[model samples]
Target: MTSRPLSILDVRSAGPAGRALCVEETAVFQHPLLEDPPASAASAEDRRRYAILQRRAEQTCLACPLLAGCLYDAVVRHDVAGYVGGTTARERARIRTLLGITVEPENLDTLAGVIGGNRPVDHDEVVRLRAAHPDESLERLAHRLGCSLSTVKRHLRRDRNGGRTREQEPRSRPSVRAVLATARTVLDPARGSRRAA
Candidate 1:
């Protein structure tokens, strides 16, 4: 059976909270300000608009029942885009850095077709590619597969472990509440500067 690539909607719907506010209200949540940080030379008006949009998006996220789950997934599981869990991509990156955590970068090209790429590389495909090119490094495989090195490793590891996915294993990462608390500390200017000092 041919399986279609999972879209953001598919993933969101599969979660316990049904669908996210961002998915329903794309205009406010998926604005460029939330998806990508403003350029360094952005005008004052642009900066003002970004701040407003950020606040709006954050409010929307804060109202969602899935905020914690969404935030944890974005910060700890997938390098997703747009405003998620009341934070921008850059903010999530900062939180990950402060937490000393790194997530596998999503194959955005596969997801959006922005770079003319196709669907995600499945486990079977990864195994076939590895068998076809026994001598190729994991990095090369990742490049050819349009995925991250960690994704390649994950697939291989899952195959070796008899199909037990990461979710089935014990997690060593911090809880969502802990991550949120850390985010507040890191993003608050007063607290952040005090901690840095």
Candidate 2:
């Protein structure tokens, strides 16, 4: 019942077009320029250097086929570090604020479940664990079930909702394309300059 968090695997599953340029150009994305900008008191030379690198990173992202998916995941699902999807972490926070969305920090314990090559936890197992330990914390329940916290949550939510999946639940949320468009607005030079002024 728990879907895996959006990852490079999800990106690659989209086929050849999903092969992210960032994966191929790992060093480029890891450069200091792709990270947060220099401090305000940084020398002009450092700032200038950052600008050059930023542009290069942006260009690389722009050329990527997975830009939309990457941007959507970065903004909505994961609080990633460094430059990704043509936006900085700060920009992503702004986008989330503007869209009135929040992403929960994933539990570190669940990371192993994400890529640990473990078998998917069954819904019945989650329910049984909860029944057996009615007073236990959800985190504890997850630990007992050997699954991610999100997976535990999902299964519980489904059980509470008469086994309806998340997709079956009616909720209003922006589309990936809408999020991508909002990112463009967030990264707009004119808007940024206005904010600076």
Candidate 3:
């Protein structure tokens, strides 16, 4: 099986949603968190500086024609290396937590190419654990799975967020045949790019 590499920029270039807020325009600005060395020690100063820059960036974004598109892409995709859509990386993380959204970190590695859908934990295993120990706290669940607390929360979030539904619980663990079938679905370059137009 083969995979065609699709850069985020290339996909965005196909559509004209966020062209106005390119990285170059925002590169000159410094994020307070990144700029401040002793952020914890300089809490008051950091907050002031952060507020000023945040306000300025947001104000600029508000005036841009591409504000909505930029914000939508930035926050949804978790592109928090620098400011876009007027929000810093930390701010975007906050937004994600509030919105019940989970942007897989692996997706950020553009060089790795597109990963269709991969979860760190199997859906069925999570379901089994939850069913077996209804009284367990999130921390305990994480400890049991040998995964981070956040990973456990991510697995269990939003009705088992990326886990299985009740209808699919009976067959939570994928069959070997099913796994092979999924593997066979990947496009092979030797087959001359099976992508449909």
Q: Pick the candidate with the highest lDDT.
A: 1
The per-model lDDT (C-alpha) reads 0.66, 0.65, 0.45
TM-score of 1: 0.56
Q: Write the per-residue lDDT of candidate 1 for residues 81-152, one digit (tens) a residue.
A: 667776677678788878877665554545566434565668899988988997666668878887765567
Off by over 4 Å in 3: 1-18, 21-24, 27-40, 43-47, 106-197
Error of 2 at 117 (Å): 18
Q: Can you tell me which runs of candidate 2 are displaced by over 4 Å? A: 1-16, 107-173, 189-197
Candidate 3 per-residue lDDT, tens place, 1-197, comes to 22423221112211334556444445434442432223454569766766566556655654565644555555554333445654455555565544445455322212333222333555457667878997665557767765544445444553544533323112233333332222222212332234321
> Deviation in angstroms for 194 in model 3?
51
Model 2 error, position 50 (Å): 1.8
**lDDT accuracy of residue 68 in candidate 2:** 72
Global lDDT of model 3: 0.45
Residue-level lDDT for 171 in candidate 3: 23
lDDT (C-alpha) at residue 149 in model 3: 45
lDDT of 2 at 76: 77
Write down the TM-score of every candidate. 0.56, 0.53, 0.37
